[model samples]
Target: MFALLFSITIEAKEIEEVVVVGAYVAEDIAEPTEDNILETIQPTKTFMLGGFNGIQLSGTDTKHTGVFKNGVPVNDPSSGWYDFGHDLSTGQKVTVITGANSVRFGSGSMAGVVLLEDNFGRSLFTQIAEDETKAMVEYDYFQIAYYKGTQGSVKSTNTENDWYENKTFKAGYDIFNIELIDYYYEYDTCYDSNFAVSDDCSVEGEKLNVSIDHDRFTLGYTNNKSTHNTGYDMESDRTYADITLVDMLGHELGISGQKETYGERERETYSAYYIWSNDNVSVGYRYEEDEHIVRLGLENDGLRFSVGNSYRLPNLYEQFGDSWVSANPDLLPEQGYGAEIGNDWVSLYYYEFSEGIDFDMNSYSYVNTGSYISKGIRFQNEISLDKGSLFVYSEFTDSDKLRVPDYRTKVSYKYLGFNVEYLGEFDKGADFDGREIDDVNTFNISFSWYPDFATEIKIEVEDLLDNKYEFIPDYNSGGRRLKLSFNTIL
Candidate 1:
């Protein structure tokens, strides 16, 4: 079930012209909206290998995707996974909705579900790029943020050196909402020491998250107590709930649950749902894995369609393992079926999987693999010229053992203050680390100006061909980086 079903927040403003399942809308705030996002996650049947990003839709190898905030269910129950590289959520919105029990915030999305909304009307944000430094503040109901970063190997790749830190706090009233987050990550990776992953590695980690929402319900707690100077040493705790049981005739119902505990294990209960939705359709039932689903979508004359079926299980750190990673509690729960059709430009999809769940980066385990299929096509366009705007996106894939690309493009333009970009990866069949690639291009240029209406300043230039595209094999892909920033509304 290598899935990708990420948005439907309030029927996405009454089905904004549907895309057979929409997403890729980062409205209203800051950055990190994709730049090696598990290999550029812009929908199109994603299947990025290594370093986390999963939902076994096809050649899928794990990380059963399911992310939500402002709707609860935020992965990481020790390792259910969700690491958009420290998830920089500033107006975070990325959508995708492929079906068949794709999502309703239950059963960890079984290979899909991404929704993160923070509703920021702006009130102070700062960024001083290059090596990373950020700040954020919002008053009238509290909000605070800070981030620090260091990446790749400033000391050498095989010599490894990575770093990270993040902190956040939030509060709101009227319908209640509360959140807290903290994390520190440090890593020293290795693999391709000619195969045999894991050779003198070091990892340090810690995380804390607490959430509360209302108007019905959603509560969460996560604490991955850690200290692994060499590997495998973690303490965990995860508890989550989603509730809202009312609204009869017109539908709308809900229920969810989760539980966790690490080490000497034994308290792993995760999955329990019963949901029903309205405006289109969505049905769910999980009652601890006896799973069931029904999903529907529509938009006639202008076209748009969808089909569903999916299921995923196998997390408890992929069945009892983490750190140096390795496990498989008889694993088995990746099932699939899909269909999609598009309109707003183009769209097409296909998925098929059975007892699949790969992820054997050379013995890092988690297999239950076999029978996989993936198909894709996506095209997007937006040309709102008057003064600015001209977006174009692309995707193409065919999957089996997975690592696809027959075309993957992205283009951007913004006029009046510049901002031109382009990305390319054509005919790749194995580039996400299966090796064998052909072209990998990227170009970026930025300029923002704006001195008034709140304030602004910007400058950027990334990889204009500093060529060194490594999407996670031995790290260090920071070929050419330069950034400068300033933002406003304070």
Candidate 2:
């Protein structure tokens, strides 16, 4: 059985950005490949500004369904790993939908699906404050960051030893009416030396949002923690509330609820959605219930669909202790049912092509009767180069053995800015233990110069001609590199 269909369409005049459901939203999708480019989009691995409301998607692998903010279901619950780049900041906006459209966000979507939108409208330091409730408490903002990177042979006899480090901190506040968020993250890695891994994460939260002009409402709580070095320590504490009603007759309604505790394992969820629009066309429906869980979804613009059924009653490392990292204590609590479909389109004018392009294509399929199933295809193209822009993307997946071909071509001919890329993974028809393996390639090249004000600097020389490839199976992924970055914005 072989089903592979590829398509591409382009029409550009881009300018659509401001749709932060849980944070990052930018129009025109597709451009990634560096071993599946953070596994096929969904915030391209991570970026964030606010925390939770409605809209949620998560995946990395190991079938564990996620999505729900006011109704609490951001997963992890012990090795489900929905890390979404650990609380993104810096003008946050993220949207990723990888591998099988993640069944539109229900039932572990098999290594893909991430949608985070949290930008809570209007900012520029709240337009100079002094008015809208004191500019929401003196326009608050905070950030702390640290990053370090290194890869292979820096010349010490070549057996290859890698390195990576990241530390982040962010804080936000909107006083008087209350809105606060705090985040912390830590990741450390060292490969080829056999074993060295560390991941630490934290999130603390509060929200009581309310807006009156177009109508809005919110209530929230989140306290989450993850610690792992292999010993794995997981904790989740949740509480939630949400309400949204917008009417001019065109209608829009949303309601939410949540309560979760992991340690002893406890659960609860509730959801509701409704919509009607005016423009071209729009429609929506959503329903959710909790205890054992149930969900239903439908939407229209191009299309969006959803269906869910769940029954998971056993947790706390699956009925108590003996954690060798976890699982199997009579393990059973993964019941299922799933569905999702999607399509999107935008064109201002297109007949032959003059000099404008923005196109997107997405396809997804999923099935789970006992446990796992997935199917995926994604394509995207964007071109507009006078100052900066050129992107191409392609993705294909069935499940796991992961093969990706990614290319990003960029040019800015003045002040010398150029980029050429080819990201790897090609196992053709893979099989293990029975033999058939040989097809791997990885490549990258980059150059930049911005020589002027607002403090700009760039120097990147990655994998220029060193390719030893093997992205996740005895490790050893790409080599030879030099990167330097500097930016200033106030």
Candidate 3:
């Protein structure tokens, strides 16, 4: 995103290096959060729900993608969807693996995998938007973060405000070839009845994790629990244990398991993987939920190629959990295959899903109805100019399935200390079943100023032209919005 890029520039030569605050994303479901941050960060790769509560790969649904922290999944174990964090700032190194390369996690990665790892330094950061403010402080191997947001809907019949609060704590210590990390997060959100799980009710969640790393392997344990105010006594206690054996001359192995007691029902899962890699090539295999997949990849002289299978197992939320829409327990698992070949400048790929799961606006529930074949190409290039520079990136995808677009293009220009970008999405000139979606375009500008060696101040404007179009039916991607960000080395 422009905000992140500007921040990176300031961080490179100004302040002492600090982790980019890339934490939680959603502010309030009653009022969808940033299209500004999430969209810009991976515009062509992701599809959003009109800048609202849902986002996933361009051709995949939320349930098909997974979010992991330090190699453990952070997605709600019950929903199987990554609903909360789309794009907030954090002090972590974020790595995204998609297409055939996603076999690293085996199942439940129909689209991709997002991995987050601790990468912090002594620093302070804060960003403020129209309805929210987030701040964080870090020192050595410790971190504390807080966020608050409030929203009021414009719908006359549902004119009420929703609020959200979040807090995070992390600490780590290393000695004698052994490392220990402790992390905790607390989330609370209350929304109006119309768009809430329960009218004017609160949903709270808590997580704590302890991990130990040794010369040969890593052992981790997590106690995750959350309570949803759905007009009922809804709460669950979940536990996870994992061990990973590091590479000893190109050999690696991993095993993980989870168990959760949800009211009268119980959920459990077990998965593992084995991989072998040297300097320029890697091969791996994963098994989960009675399904197995193999992946292969290689790179040399700025060229890359990969091939593998993708799969996912449905979770309770997709089948029976209640939310803004009804649940469908009849949903089936997803299976697919994909391959890609390209280099640094351009790439071509293909993927086909025999059975893909997704949220169907027509049925108002989850469905295995997005299956189809897709082919695509990507191009990225940069040109230097007399004053600044110009960067161009574009992708065109053709899918036999509905609910997906065929083209996306992004052009950005940097002049002096200011950055401007333009994004355009075009719907395929075809027909489909559910809600009729339309094309959407957005423009943005950002500027950063370093007042001192240890500090930076940046301003950004999203949807600069106030263009309103429908990427999702009946939802209005709001008008222009502004954000101010500041960070300093402690």
Candidate 4:
């Protein structure tokens, strides 16, 4: 009874103006064109720049949002933060929403959301074997990566130390209705001078999912566990059950419940929703309730809007740690209400002069009565021709004084099957009491090529101007660097 429609619109004419969904375009005409447009639109800094690797370019204290494999909610019971470091292989698509977006999402969506889908193509191994439809007998993929960097500046003496390692594995079995995925990540960093700081972090987790389908209904369960070690060690375990009612007023009704435990803090959430679509509009509402928590959401077309309120209960660390040296024992859980509104649109066919052009934009705002209010804007555009394409984007955030530039502009073009790009970041400086802080600027270029029946090759030169832009205050030293990479499918 629940009907879900998936459709793709193909434009026959040439591309003219390109627009990216949930993205932004900078005001500068000199900005590079090859930059990844997603970075310009989404609120977070984490983005896939072609390879399996993604860059967490900038840091923001906002909640990240992500979608389930089937476009369902992947809610977080504790802090409502979406962990982007997890395995992304299951994701068919990823969209990052920036800033306070309560009006568009719900109460706790003070930061932004990351929407994910599971319909993307298979990995190299899956494609080569041509067996993506059937489960593999054994895990068939593996990869390893390592990185190191340093920093230097004029305002403050400093040293940079950072490193990371990551691994992932996946397998499935049809007989048992089982699928498994495991992920691990480790990172360490040290900064002395300017502002003394040191952090050592590691995270490891696995997810086991099982489902059973019948004539009228479906049932599924998922078990997830993750361990984190930073200044302190913490572990989280979650179990969830989902049910689908096939015949519910010409629509599919879904209900889910989850229980999560972290240290001495425990919480439970229950949610239910109905989805259906016609030729013109798609509509649905989701309702969720738990201890000190209540949320509801509505959706139509490419827009999902929601609102809710929640109360944070004190955790074991906050309720018992020493105040003088350790955690604060008197800390209170954050409580607030929020809402969000958003949408996405694509053109099947438009004017000829605008051939190969696409456009996308999103703007949102949110307020926490007990905390702070925030707003953000993101836009992206792409234009494609016979030779290649061009991309442009921009992002901006406004607080009390618009203290940070946070704005970025980029462009990319392709010719003869080769792609090139340029990127730039705006100056984000603030007048602390009265004195003006120095703002930084940066420029980078990269090229990639693919030959017949061979691997893809890439070369990049960063900080071309050698401008001492401080990604973090006085923590300069990104400096100039050249990088090369090669990728092939077996």
lDDT tens readout by residue for model 1, 395-421 = 776777554555777788889888877
Writing each residue's lDDT as its tens digit, candidate 4 over 1-490 gives 0111113222211111111122211221111121222333332222212112222212223332322322233443332443443443332244444322122233333334444322222223111111111111122222222222222212244332322222333322221134455654433343333334554445555655443333333344545565545334445455655566553544556666666665566667676655453333334445554433343344555654544443333333333332222443445455544444454322110001101111111211121223433344544567787767776555554433323455655566766645555555555555433334445444556676777464555666656777654444433333565655444444
Q: Where in model 3 is the C-alpha error above 4 Å?
A: 1-41, 44-55, 84-87, 129-131, 150-164, 173-238, 260-263, 319-331, 359-367, 381-387, 400-403, 428-433, 469-471
Better of 3 and 4 by lDDT: 3
Worst 10 residues of 2 by lDDT: 126-135
Winner by lDDT between candidate 2 and candidate 1: 1
Residues 1-490, candidate 2: write the lDDT tens digits.
0111112222211112111111112332222111111233422211111211112222113324243332234554433334433332323334543222122233333233444323232222111111100011112333443333334322223444333333443333331121232333222232222345322222232222211111254444555554444445556665666556554565566666566666666677666656554443334444553332333334455454444444333444443432332333454454544444444321111011011111111211111123343334444455666866766544344432222222112222222466655544444343333334334443455565556654344555545676654433333445555555444333
Native-structure RMSD, model 2: 24.3
In order, how many clashes per candidate? 14, 23, 7, 54
The TM-score obtained by model 3 is 0.75
Per-model CA lDDT versus the true structure: 0.57, 0.35, 0.59, 0.38
lDDT tens per residue, model 3, 1-490: 2233223321111111111111111111110123323443354423322123444453555666666555456566556665433234455555555546534454666445665455558888888888867777888767777666543432223445455566767665441111122222222234444545333444565656554433333445544455556443344445655556554787778776777555455678888887776556777788888888787777777677777787776766667756555868678887888777777667777778888666677777878875677778877677999999998978787876555568888899998669898888787454445556667688889887888888878888977988755445542344576888888889
Arranged by TM-score, best first: 3, 4, 1, 2
On lDDT, the leading prediction is: 3
